[model samples]
Target: MWTVAGEIMGLWSRDIPEPNEVTFTTMIGALAQTDQFKEALELFRLMLRKRVPVDSVSLSSILGVCAKGERDIGLCHGLSCNAQGKQIHTMSIKLGFDRDLHLSNSLLDMYAKIGDMDSAEMVFVNLNQHSNVSWNIMIAGYGNRCNSEKAAEYLHRMQCDGYEPDDVTYINMLTACVKSGDVRIGRLIFDCMPSPNLASWNAILSVYNQIADHREAIELFRKMQFQCQHPDRTTLAIILSSCAELRLLEVGKEVHAAAQKFGFYDDVYVASSLINMYSKCGKMELCEHVFSKLPELDIVCWNSMLTGFSINALEQDALSLFKQMRSLGFFPSEFSFATIVSSCAKISSLFQGQLFHAQIIKDGFLDDIFVGSSLIEMYCKCGHVHGARCFFDLMPGKNTVTWNEMIHGYAQNGDGRSALCLYSDMISYGEKPDDITFVAVLTACSHSSLVDEGLEIFNAMLPKFGVVPKLDHYTSIIDCLSRAGRFHEVEVFLDTMPCKDDAVVWEVVLSSCRIHANVTLAKRAAEELYRLDPQNSASYVLLANTYSSLGRWDDARVVRDMMSDKKVLKYPGYSRSVCKNDTQMILENKQ
Candidate 1:
């Protein structure tokens, strides 16, 4: 029928036969499949003019067109509210399709796609009997809006209402749990499944993987295979993530073998995850092998390979691959930029980072907070904090991440005073500072030896900003006091901290004592640091150096003898400088 209609339309040329409602609807469906929505809309209008019967399928086809083609979220919402979906909705009601489960479900899904959750709920609430699919749609909609608790609530409510969820529904629920990182609830949901499929197993495994429960993820995967449910692409993705975090080379090989056995090695998502896993585990050769075997690549594939190279400090290779991706017309997402720019920062490739920054501006993503923050980080790391500041100031809107980046930039550049000032500015602008922001501000004071200022900011955070100091924040304050030669104050502060004395806090004071050549405090710090990081030879070496710097020759000799007795040799110091376009190792000391 479609072929005959197409032939007729082709033969008529400019004066094509006026298509009837059924013919127009079928043609619209075809156009929608090809994503030629504008022509479909015109055909629908002609059908209305000719008074042809507009059925539910025809109405839903137009709504699908609006949902797919509309880019503006607000405009899509307005369309769902007014003209776009209005006529079709009224037609559905008049034709009794509103009472039809399939038509109503499609309308709910369409509104959800357009971010018209209110309309979707209205449609959902009016349903005489809600299917598990409808319940899942509502849950997924809430998840899309970052309302994970509401999503979980809906899932619970669905169960309470006696709608047994299918695999799709469980996937949505598990996804919400993953997003919320509510492992306890996720486990409960997992336990309640009548007969869990491989996908559900994968979701459970993923929840564990996300929360750094690698041992649990591995155990779950073993249990999954024992149950004779073969791992699919999703299963492999989660398994590889666990291996990546744990760097369990031996177990990762087993997962790799499983991938080959299942023949999911060619799957792009699985392959990408595998590449990331191998790269993070420091198996670059295997990462390359996996990359070479994949016949087709997506943006994620490219990103994974680039990220792998960057993680291994293979900056040049990463850049070359990035260029290859661009030549293939694969536009880099913000994540790609973030990775490449961070690699640029690591290698001090300011020129390349700047070039990427220019490209970001040309692509009109300069205002995007993620991209802007990446640029800021790269600039600060390359000793161009002023450039970073300029970019940050020009950002149209500042998110918490962006603000954190700017504050960190100030801290890294030794402008801790400026960082503290920016913190004040951030609060004045009504933007609440997160824990990361407080860390940056406090670290700035520590670096610049602003003990009093650091104390004030640390105290103000709990009351004024309502940001309770974390371990890192407390450590930074202790370091600030130590840097100013206020060792007793640091010791007193440590005694009063709510959290346990982290090795990092002890290390901070120890290093500060070494810098100031405070022998008495250095001994106290050394004792505490050694108790915390017993295997760290740096602590021993640093304490010995403090004694040497203070001309306490006997004490330094005794410290060195103790190190020798323990078979803990000091790591040789080395320095580097870029001279005439060449990196030269200028110094080295051997035992």
Candidate 2:
């Protein structure tokens, strides 16, 4: 159709000695509509060179073309189009069309779209009259820049100027809220709307999802249903994600039914989300059923299935599916490589992991941060810390996760000095240590018996690094002290720790006490654990074992009687090993 239109315009230019303003206007508008932006601008310039009087319609059409072209080229190369738009603006004022509301609004839109909000504001301030569109353009401009405060100010001004915000206004405000992650403000804005459209509902739902408030997202989804608002593809996908996060299988199945009813079950995003929801719920059969039923699968759906297998400890199956995916002509994305590499790590398949690493290098994803981090973790988990360090050093760029993985690799391999040195380098390189970094470092210190160094690091966590210690950090420090036979210090530290009531804290303390033969502290730790987590049999067993090891038969028997009275039966321990032929064998302790 565009080619036909261009041929006719060519014939007209050849046949007619001079095309009138209407002729040029019609041609330029047609080109702009078809996304022939360069052709549209060339024709507009031709009209000027022909000494033809450019009308308001022609100017508005050209401005629209410039705005769209600038946006298409992105902000980096938008200056040229911005220069042309300003020239058009100057020409509009000279032609006495500056006061024309439509022309003025077009100029405003062009400025805003080009990211020249200051010029947009200038054009807006000079306008004699304002429409809802004018106000919306300004609000949306600020919203796009993530300046939510300015958008709110304009929204208030629009209301004060006797222009009730339409659906567009509210939706734009919600978009700002989504960008800024202000759920409270987003909900207030949604509630203030007399009648929110489906887009509005989706916007607020996204806001809740962005901050990981999945429960609220689900609750809002229910409210949306009660209001009789039909769920679209996006609505279903968002709700499914919330269900996946909470592992709400029953709720997820209901959403699956809703998707079928709405005829959105085959939508790619919705299908992938269904796979993910089932996978997270530990329903591998249901996950497989969803995957097999998909008639057409995109990379996202395949990645979802691979992730399911990895999370369910079916690493061999995941690898087989990966091979099948490639054989079927689906190009693996970075996420695909990351998932399979993680699976290899889970099963300690160093040979396969190295093969994947070679493939990652060949496929040019070696620079990808996620893939790099996963490779590091895989090497570390497969008992190859040096291999992990080699990859860590070769990477051109590194984020906090990359740094943490290498440090954790060293820590897990019992190289405390190397982990601490890498941690110092991380700080020197300006990467802030998060809670996980501290856990790895403290664990390294505990395993190496660096008691004084561990104490110094723990004490500096709050004042120096601004990271308030959590339960895991406190537990790591306690274990470090307990390993060094500093029971007095451990007791004092436990008394002062904020998470003293947590079962995990007491459990660690009890385990350490039993190892160090502090029967009195072990008893106290056992009682705390019993109060915190009554169903756990480890506490009772650990306490009884402590008594037995110390030649106190009466105390051990008493503890065993208490356990029997409480009906806390200890389950037999078991070990799993993968055979050479890729099968699992479980060995249960009979004694």
- In the order shown, the candidates' Cα RMSDs to the true structure are 5.2, 4.2
| Cα-based lDDT at residue 529, candidate 2 | 87
How much does candidate 2 score in TM-score? 0.87
Give per-residue CA lDDT, model 1, range 1-591, as digits (tens).
354434546664556565566777777888878876555665676567768888877887777776665553334333432356656777789887888777787777767766678998899999998898789888877766666788888888998999888888877777777877778877888888888987789789978977888999899899888988998888888888888888888888899999999898788898898898899999989988988898988899889998999989888789889999999899998888888888887777678889899998887787777888888998998889999889889899888999999899899989988898888899899899989998898889988878789888888888987778889988888888988898778878878888655778777878899988877777877788767777678778889899888888899889888878878766676655532113422232333
Clashes per prediction?
0, 0
TM-score of each candidate structure, all chains considered together: 0.79, 0.87
TM-score of 1: 0.79
lDDT of 2 by residue, 1-591 (tens): 464445655798789767889988998889889998877887887788778888999999999999999866433233577889999999999999999999998998899878899999899999999999999999888888887888899999999999999999999999877777667777999999997899999999988887999999999999998999999999999999999999999999999999999898678789899999999999989988888888899999999999999988888889999999999999999999999999988777788898899999999999999999999999998789998999999999999899999989888889999999999999999999989999999999999888998899899999999998998999999989988989999999888888878888778778887888899999999999899888899999899999988999999999999999999888886665555124333333342
Model 2: residues >4 Å from true position, as ranges? 1-95, 110-120, 145-149, 580-591
RMSD, model 2, all Cα superposed? 4.2
Clash pairs, candidate 1, are none
Best by lDDT: 2
Report lDDT per candidate. 0.81, 0.89
